[model samples]
Target chain A: MSDAKTAIDVNALLQAIPYARFLGITVDQRGNEITTVLHFSQRLIGNPVLPALHGGAIGAFLETTAVAQLAFEFAGAGNGKVVLPKPIGLTIDYLRSGKPVDTYGRAEITKQGRRVATVRAEAWQEDRSRPIAAAHGHFLLQVAEDAAAS
Target chain B: MSDVDFSPEDLMTMKDVLIEHVPHAKAIGLKVEDVKLSEAWLSVAYSEQLIGNPETGVIHGGVITSLLDNACGIAVQLTLPGRMSIATLDLRIDYMKPATPKLDLMAHTHCYKVTKNIAFVRGTAYHTDEKDPIATCVGTFMLAANRAQPLPTTSKAATEAMKILAQKKGGDA
Candidate 1:
């Protein structure tokens, strides 16, 4: 019943999603914190001249972090899988160019209402203090059935 | 932005060159279907690799974000007189519905206005109908290098475009 007792597999939850796999995303959970990592790959380059990571790629990775965090929070530990949350909208502010390096993302639940949850996520390349981008997202959470299948 | 005496034909030829440099666009199979001064249309066909929720077979919302972002960026580039370093300063995407599996996603973007340091763009992603969009986005891009501050003429261009779009929808309906 408690989050501490529930063994959540955020990586497994990510692996089941094809786009997450395509993006080469993995999770690092330390206690209650889950930080999603986007592995550096050549295919992620948007500006070949500057060799910066694609903006869309960074946006997607950050969004994935938020969704995984939401699932980790709501999915009961020992549950086989977590039903994925759907994003209603996202506002991404690119503070700095995404360097072509391994990027890290983390999401914090800013607000949790009845049918919706708001999350704030940020991505950093080298220094956590200096984030390359940040996002505020709204998600539609299906709590009526929780993990009930269609 | 001042006028760039470019014909739609001139910009149309640069569509491939516009997307060839971005590896992510190629990785996701994004193509520039059409391009004009301050306007662009791009599309990405659905594939298993792009699916978000495998159970329902819907394309990931990220794909839509990428498509819309690129479309907005390309529209800004098409507006400029020459190629310049344009960075997406910010982008906001509003999802209207999940993308239908196996249906190609297309986005049309317009850079309606440009100021000294920024270019404003609005875009919509849809299967075949723009009115029934899967997602809509508005973004601002920071322009670098050769640029100028000019009167707002593109808004008129945008209004003309709206009339054309309205007529097309009416005909389709």
Candidate 2:
């Protein structure tokens, strides 16, 4: 449980979405900066022959990372309830492919507005110096009253 | 409409032709998995070479876009029946989560409708955990008659694939 200003339970949110749980995304720790890990595996198949991971998979990873950043911020708001933010647009730059191992992602809150929030997210394998992909997105925040009444 | 024939191997070769034609796709290792009247599936695996940050171990987003774009094209080919080439008008993807390390993704893409030149498609990517879709994509493709003659081998292969699919369905039924 969180205060009125803080967001809802992070673990609760993660469990709510089956896909998020499958990706191994958890709250980790809640604050301005947040970290989430996606345990990479070879089971994710694209072309059975090449068996290389698909690009769309990377994009989803980036998008989810970005959303999680927003959620972390929301939780930090101390509202005691996590809010679901919708992405209006996202632009990703794919720099490289992921290796056969777990990859980590981090996010920075560039700007937070009344209606929209801007976030920048990056993913890396073992090291932080270089990232496999980088993404920037605009998220529209939804308040509980607006969200629940719907 | 002239009847064109293609075998599975011929279809595989034509896939190479399509990839070679797209310069960006060629650089990224985009490949076609299956092609039919209104459905298709495409895949690419995780690779260290494809990461933007080698130190951090992450894959690029553009690669995913390329896969989705190719899937949309294949979906359009399914509607044309005859020889057809397709172009993407617009594509939007909803990334649900980040990909796992080393795991490849298969985009199970299919065309839902084709009206005139507009072809609509929807697809999702899954690894071992089908419940967690790595990405979801929706796109519109512009269908145009192909100038090149349909490879005889591709036509034949498509027929066979369809037959197999039908048999499997029949057995299940």
Candidate 3:
């Protein structure tokens, strides 16, 4: 982790992904960790009877947060530019039902190399200790050549 | 567990009800295409709202995940004896390739196994050619003990149709 934090417009970066906008995902960066938030909405409900948040929605939120965290780290690395990381594979485990409420998520970069990166993410509504779901995935990092050309 | 003798028409009505009740599925424009004893096919039309990368005009991976998840759940429902609530326990998906822009996506899912409380599923999503899939998924769902209420029928005829189809299946078997 870099001790020096770079000035990056996290909102603008998230806005680039249109689906993030649809889900109303927001970011909160304090120290070294970046927290993602998804406010409750009727459109995000999957089981109307339980009024539980859609499993897909939770998966999407975690994936998006992981991608955003990587982009943020890349921007801080030097060039201050963000590139979209392509997801290769994702595995999510649902620990509990996501009650309809404002959900929070955080992603940790387990490994980062020149071409690939691995991220682990978790989401929770009320208590961080009790996560509703957790996801870990591998992504193809944007190489310097592609970043420079773009 | 009692076996459910469901005809083709009865399965179709059940699919319609399931899709209609799942708000997220309805919002994503997911439609059940076909349903059999332990398998199902679902389709999602291309929409601008689902675009993840505006530059390439490709739909988001999340949309594909949602479709696959829902498809697997539907397959699990078909495999069970009667109406029961089910929740996804875990899902793993591998993106083989980016989806074709402006093209609809389809998922074919099968419930491979069912235990007392768990149902396992496998599925594939494709754009046009079934041979070339965009993604593949395997998942597990936990079945609730209580019987779930049937989704509201779109028409009285649909309910009647299901009864007739059930009768036909019972007679044939």
- Candidate 3 ranges with C-alpha deviation above 4 Å: A1-5, A147-150, B1-3, B145-173
State residue B43's C-alpha deviation in candidate 2, in Å.
13
The residue pairs found clashing in candidate 1 are A6-A77, A7-A77
Off by over 4 Å in 1: A1-5, A77-81, A144-150, B7-9, B145-173
Predicted candidate 3 versus true structure: per-residue lDDT over A1-150, tens digit per residue: 456757576667887777888888888877666788997765776765554668888888888988888877877564565667888999999998887678999898999987889999999988999999999999988855685676
TM-score of every model versus the real structure: 0.87, 0.51, 0.87
- The digit string of per-residue lDDT tens for model 1 on A66-123 reads 9999998887732535678899999999998887689999999999987789999999
lDDT of 3 by residue, B52-165 (tens): 877788888999888999899888888888767788999999999999999999999999899999999999999877789999999999988235433344756434543443
Which lDDT value does model 3 have at A97? 83
* Descending-TM-score candidate ranking: 3, 1, 2
**Candidate 3: what lDDT?**
0.82
lDDT of 2 at B3: 37
Give the count of colliding residue pairs in each prediction: 2, 70, 0
Candidate 1 accuracy as lDDT:
0.83
